[model samples]
Target: MTASLSWQKSTYSQEQGDCVELAVIGGAVLLRESDNPAVVLRTSRANLADFLQVIRQGPAKNSPPGR
Candidate 1:
């Protein structure tokens, strides 16, 4: 199934291993680690966008006393 999809690595990735690759198929987005190509994660574009947004925002302000 992954053979047909075009996987893309992040520009920030400098090494051959330990990098994340992404591919879009139909209405879903696919992701996998270069070192572990056999394991893949599928999610919608909207959900991926939300996850990226949260990552960009850094840690949340409201957390337990001892984080």
Candidate 2:
């Protein structure tokens, strides 16, 4: 939202409006839904990394419909 960080859409973003955006600001991770970018969620980089590792090892985040 501010000029401090740049937000990028999730690589796994889908066409049906299921989009995730992320930014790194002030040594923390910021996340928002592309459909509604106003609401921001903050988390630690370490926590985000751990969750990503689990998701990467377990299941895909945005699997397309009927795949």
Model 1 misplaced regions, further than 4 Å: 65-67
**lDDT of each residue in 2-50, candidate 1, tens digit only:** 9889999988898755899999999999999988999999999999999
| Weakest 10 consecutive residues of candidate 1 by summed lDDT | 58-67
TM-score of 2: 0.67
lDDT values for all models = 0.92, 0.82
lDDT of 2 by residue, 3-52 (tens): 46698888777767668889988889899887787889999999998988
Count clashes in each candidate, considering only residues at least 3 apart in sequence or on different chains: 0, 0
Query: Each model's TM-score?
Result: 0.87, 0.67
Q: lDDT score, residue 10, model 2?
A: 81
Best by TM-score: 1
